[model samples]
Target: MNLKKHILALTLLVSNFIFSQNTYVFLGSYNLDKSAESIQVYQLNTKNGNLNKITGVKNIINPSYLTVSPNGKYIYACTDTKTPNAGSVSSFEFNPENKTLTFLNKQTSGGENPVYVSVHKNGKWLVNANYTEGSVSVHPLLENGTIDSTAQNFQYTDGSVHKERQTRSHVHSAIFSPDFDYLFLPDLGADKIRCYQFDEKQKKPLTEAKVAFTKTNLEAGPRHFTFHPNQKFGYCIEEMAGSISVYKYKNGTLQKIQRINTHSDEIKEGFASSDIHISPDGKFLYASNRGKENNIAIFAIDKKGLLKNVGYQSTLGDHPRIFALDETGKFLIATNVNSGNVIVFQRNPKTGLLKKTGNEIQMENVSCVQIKKIKP
Candidate 1:
């Protein structure tokens, strides 16, 4: 009986290890020269939030933002640049067998300084936000995961209240609505969340939606936007203004609900807020505050769609550029751009709080963490 008990326990442990999912972490980064590798891949252990380096992709310059397709067969990156006609978007085939990326093709983004890129759930179109030239563009994606060409584009010329930072239109992020019916763009320089009707089934896809655009408070400088899992509430993290603006969302239209500051009262100077994302369950929201207070501001979302400050936690590094939660929402990885490290934190699902796991992945200027789960 004793031998049988030990055998049963050992067999169960091996079965669990084989059945567990392997998560692939793709780190986007800034590459100064062509020789320096920019994109790094790692396998994150689910048992503990530890990252093991897998491989690195070189020759791509400054992939500031990355998005994986729904099918997990393609990876898209936005090349961060300022020179006119130089900014671009690149697509690659994600090989699951060896965990490597193969160059597919590249297309010119509508304008300079392409900062963010998001893909349609159907995998038909890839949208990019141009910061320096204040424009947005959409490209047709191939069935085999290669990019074809730019299909449609829009340019925003207006500037906002900030004299230096808001000198002209800066398109920060372009994200598809929950149902993939509309495309919402947050323009930092224009202080607006621009809306457009998107139809990937058409010959030429992007067009104006029922409501062309929604305006935030003047000088708000909306940088990033995230939708609730329920699809009724929307949140925008303002960059220059350092606040989160809540809205009631439906059919590509956003109606203002409430607004709250992400920084504490003591944080008066050097306010720069970067990214925002809600938990998978939609019970909590997280926003990164850069500049003076380098920490992530946590908030709880009540049933009424209102936000209450839960707490703030240190990022253990400078300039938390972007962060993402795992598939299970059990762990979070934050990329600190200035401090050149990516830190992992264990999350409590019940309380929606983060505790650093003390496992750090040292890198060079990582800007984004895109998580993909590998299924057996």
Candidate 2:
């Protein structure tokens, strides 16, 4: 082949590859007695693994936990508040072309302090966790991504030994199984993960499972849980004990397998866990530890879904409340609430360990981090 022709062909191939890959990061701020709530958007350069703020700063109202749509065209956040009993979930239509978001609609969360929200796999129903009210609510979503007014709310009164944290059942998070057949609600105050048969078409739970399983340690305060991609195994992070418990789930039944501590043996007291997540490839798991131990615990996932501690890495900031992995699994962003910054880390694919990239973005009371791929 002629030299000129070969060069042209290579240029075309490179351009096509670059155009097919894109990513963006959206951060949720706590507001923390501030004037306005805000969410920051950033465009990620896939080639160099660098991130640049693209949407400037869009202000909302106390957006605590944010979730992106399955199609990546919309972003939803929980607008948590206590004044006048106004708590709602807001939706934003994302413009991937310009990396901007447009406010779509807002709907009441049916309870106070809606700290967490999740969309079912079918994208037909939205579930919320009301921390202060200790309840779970389900809202139906319209085709335009707006929520319906009618909601189904359920409150729990169970409690465990942890009088301070679990005095009243506090629903922390609600997640659906991969098949959208069952809904799992983690209650910090009850120290239990309740299972419900979810009916997406009806937008409500069919009936309570005969057996509702509780965690091994009462007052451990299970806050969040993440399931494996295959849907056979799951892991839950305990906020009070700073530990993780592995479980084998099948046919709506969860059997405890193992529990591992997030802190070192030498260190004692003043440690709490915030969030837990599994990699897209289902090969590794990561959990965040706050309060004195500002680090991420990395674990390797075996074929049997057992967890083996790989290692731990400092988040390079204080209070790593929440962290998320980029779609490509190349970068991880940890939101440091106390430090008022979001620290970026590069993930080693083979070892599943995080290395600080030395690129930190400053923000106030950052609580949650969510990422989506942008369109060209």
Candidate 3:
């Protein structure tokens, strides 16, 4: 072949390879009936916002909440089931080229009904919240991204007055600070946000005077909390009372600055708030409201770390359990459980508003949405 022709062919090959790298949407499905678990995976076209199911129509038990590893090579799922004992967390190696998952191993979560799991920033530890046991547990991550045995477990023993929801302490979610120095456990039943001294080097939790606790409104039932990427502020979604509590963090202490109702005054019926998240740029906050409300409440974060109501958008489905922001901060996906679908929205970066993208991916009882980038 001529030199010019060979160069042109190589360029075309590179362009084709780049175009083939697919963005994926992974849904964690829940099975209230059997034990065999399944997670749905779909290939998403970034150019036109189209989703095609690649594989994983089968069932996987209890992968209700999921988090991708820092390297984006592994995906960890919190199976909210108690097989012989309590539920456990599992790891899966991801193949970005083919959009498939390979199971690695599982570790007992050291409590019951493990709802959420997150990896420490250093990638040295994995933390989980056990709802039924009302506890938080830490697991060491092996060099290959699998979890070691449970190293440390802390059980919360307090409860509040919401008879149906807060009868006992239920730790719904645990997350690390941006600096990875401390861990925050939001216990729904206890009406408290428990701060723990995290030892990254030792892969354990320490009981120390550094512990700080913040109180939520009685019967508020704090579910999931997310910190602003800048680490100056935090937000928590109260499940039972359907409210959002804003907090300011300084020197390892969290001070409650404001609490805002997630719903309008006209809708007085009780609803359950599910997940809370802040945008990557810290300009907006999003919370999911389930039950009859069935919408995502959006807020604008002011310069002073206070939230001003932006607006609310219906998830366009039932039981909006969890929603996630894409890596580019350009799109948001809401997992509607009862409706068995995930609705996509295009995010306006400048205004921090979400517009319906008219893209809905069908699945079964999807409780959580997770995204992983396809490597080149």
Using TM-score as the yardstick, the better of models 2 and 3 is: 2
Q: Report the number of the highest-TM-score candidate.
A: 1
Q: Given candidate 1, what's the lDDT at residue 165?
A: 83
Full ranking by lDDT? 1, 3, 2
Better of 1 and 2 by lDDT: 1
Candidate 2 lDDT for residue 106: 88
Scanning candidate 3 in windows of ten residues, the lowest lDDT window is 203-212
In the range 1-376, model 1's lDDT, one tens digit per residue, is: 9999999999998876653446788888877666776888888887787788777788888888899898888889987554456889998887766877887888898798899999999888889999989999988888888887888888989988788888888989998889988999999998889998888888678888878889898888899999999999999999877999999998889999999999988987667999998889888899999889889898999997889998898899999989998887888899999999999998888888899999998888889889888665
- Worst window of 10 by summed lDDT in candidate 1: 15-24
Give TM-scores for every candidate, taking all chains together and pairing residue i with residue i. Answer: 0.95, 0.93, 0.91
Give one digit per residue, the lDDT tens place, for model 3 in 151-177.
888887789987777778899998887
Better of 1 and 2 by TM-score: 1
User: Could you give candidate 2's per-residue lDDT for residues 265-316 as a string of tens digits?
Assistant: 6668776899999888899999999888899999999998988888999988
Off by over 4 Å in 2: 2-21, 32-37, 56-59, 82-84, 203-206, 374-376
Evaluate all candidate structures by whole-model CA lDDT and list the values in order. Answer: 0.87, 0.81, 0.82
* Candidate 1 error regions (>4 Å): 1-15, 18-21, 80-85
